[model samples]
Target: MKGFLEDANYSIGLLDEGATLADIIDNCIYEHTHTGKRAFYVGDLGKLVKKNTQWQNVMAPIKPFYPVKCNSTPGVLEILGTLGIGFACSNKSEMVLVQDLGISPENIIYTSPCKQASQIKYAAKTGINIMTCDSDIELKKIARSHPNAKLLLHIATEDITADEEMNMKFGTTLKNCRHLMECAKEFGIQIVGVKFHISSTCKDLQTYIHAISDARCVFDMAEEFGFKMNILDIGGGFTGSELQLEEVNHVIRPLLDVYFPKESGVNVIAEPGCYYVSSAFTLAVNIIAKKTECDKLLPSGVEQARDDEPVFTYYINDGVYGSFASKLSEKLNTTPEVHKKYKEDEPLFTSSLWGPSCDELDQIVENCLLPELSVGDWLIFANMGSGTLGEQSTFNDYQRPLIYYMMSFSDWDEMQDAGIASDTLMKNFFFVPSCIQLGSEDRFSTAA
Candidate 1:
């Protein structure tokens, strides 16, 4: 946490006791209106601490290696590093980022299946020996660049999802696993384990049963070749849902006991990207412009609507090209709560939110009922920390919004209880006073 304090790239605001997240957001919104409104993010660092505790309770024994590509916010990395979680880096820059935080080389795994040769050399020089590879080209690259590299054979478990799209992008088939093992043997690369990913879109928990079963098969095959297979990576598909996590755990725990029992000396890990960060941050975007039409048909693709009703199109400062970039692949959970209070009796109308880029593709929220808001009013989108910052593609001189990191005193205490008592961590504990005046007219938004 202290590393990012002086780094100028991030700003963390420590909240006083009872100083709610909404208070900080209220203060920020008040200040922004005085100057001019721009999009900004409020990250509740306390949520990360809570999520870590939840992970420990539910997903114990299976260590978590956070994929840095998901949301590489410095504050997130700092907090997760402090929690002693291993990192799954995909490139040299990510590896360097974690190592700079004093992470041991063994605590990091280079996860780029198709890594660049120079980056592979960089990992070799830096002692990042654990890496994932799926094909002979990758094995050859690792062998030539870093012969001592330990490899996790990235196997594409039979894609049972409706699209089977994720497997096509990475992972070698089970049949190809033998050939990959043979190639590693020829190239003198160390094939140490197996790794597979289940897309978040995959609903079937049976997929885990099949994938874990496939991994066991590979481990058995490794015995014939004399390669000691130890690690089993049940890769990312976790969607910040407690029931889903518990459900998945219930299915996998028994299978793990049956296949790779405790005495097997196998280390189990999962790459959880969104599970840790998504619900921890909120984005605040201002309504930059507005247009209203009466008795007109609503937008075509928007989900909810009433025909021949008033429709409003709101242009926000940030859009799909910026903070909401995740909208490209996954749907945006962008039904924002209005930032300004209004009467409960105020009529709601079908509204569409768009970006200032003026591109028709820049729509943020397709269709939702919103209180008719003025251009200067703000909107708050919760659960935005899931790779939104890392996925942004800014256009039209749009600067990346400043992230305001926040943590409650109780959470800070809990973090200490969790055994992160590094002296440097307290250096940047800039606590705010509990009694903050949130202006005369507006304080914070709520159900109206």
Candidate 2:
């Protein structure tokens, strides 16, 4: 634990014998509010959009259509609505939400490739007239249901990835793309454009260029068949984190300049879900349990949870079941770096971190490097949840914590005379409630 403290850059006081984990959470919550501490803070989407000027500068040449599935929180959607960016809705429910939010119908591209007939009909009925299709069957289904609908031909590429497999389920292979375009002509349906994706976490620079080249070929095929394909819906997979945006731009910008000829009368569109929301927040969790054991070579190789002779365990209130379960299920090697507040100099070791859930598989870190940890400690989970820690709240049956937009200086002045700060002040900011303490019986039962 001494090593964990120093490595995390947190100062550790003498352990209090009577203290419990819940006590730590309560104290932290109070301290966060009073001292204006934020457990998670969403990056300002609007500000980011403004700074990058993506819609105006970078994404201008390549039109951006926001994918609502990434975050879709009201706050997120409202901002996109204000930006006048088009939306990529996969279902009727999303269309309904778009309508409720008063998004313009012209700004919606119903991009669900494998869609129910009712969803298709509702899209046509609700006036969300644009959609995507990859197969002759799905094309036929839409044409039969909404005969007069405007459809975009979906093209498959080996480039992009996302949480959902967009290409496998709905996109047409290059040969199939030509076939689908011919099918569109047969069904008397208008094919307005084509779409593709650079799969999530794409590691190559040529991925975008290759996809655009493929799209151009599809466009040329449509032209050969006397179809006027004006829109190219390059489906969402734009990198979201500002940390990676520069790298993304390096990989993407040149591709756009190369294949996108202004004379072609084709408008490039992208469905960027994470790009709009990934850097928006952080998560702070209370440490529930800390254990140390000596171990040799362990199967998991986690210093904390080694199956060897020695192992250490640090339990947090949240875990895979609640906050990051889907990501874990995918066996993705990506893990959040722990933000240390205690000891920064402690030796980091391979350790396992578990969620507070009773399920044995409920864990956050399978094997990670950390100094050590003790009970009643607070740690930060960066990029928590789907789009910061705001994505999945109440996952472990924990109630959603209050989201506070830390006051700016101007707003602070407005309430300065009200004693809002003074009233919320506390001697110590780290405390948790006593009612939810982890009992020995609970731990023992789970181990069995």
- Which candidate should be chosen as best, given lDDT against the real structure? 1
Q: Residue 349 lDDT in model 2?
A: 68
Worst 10 residues of 2 by lDDT: 1-10
In the order shown, the candidates' Cα RMSDs to the true structure are: 5.0, 11.6
The Cα local distance difference test for each model comes to: 0.83, 0.59
Question: All candidates' TM-scores?
Answer: 0.91, 0.70
User: lDDT value for candidate 1?
Assistant: 0.83
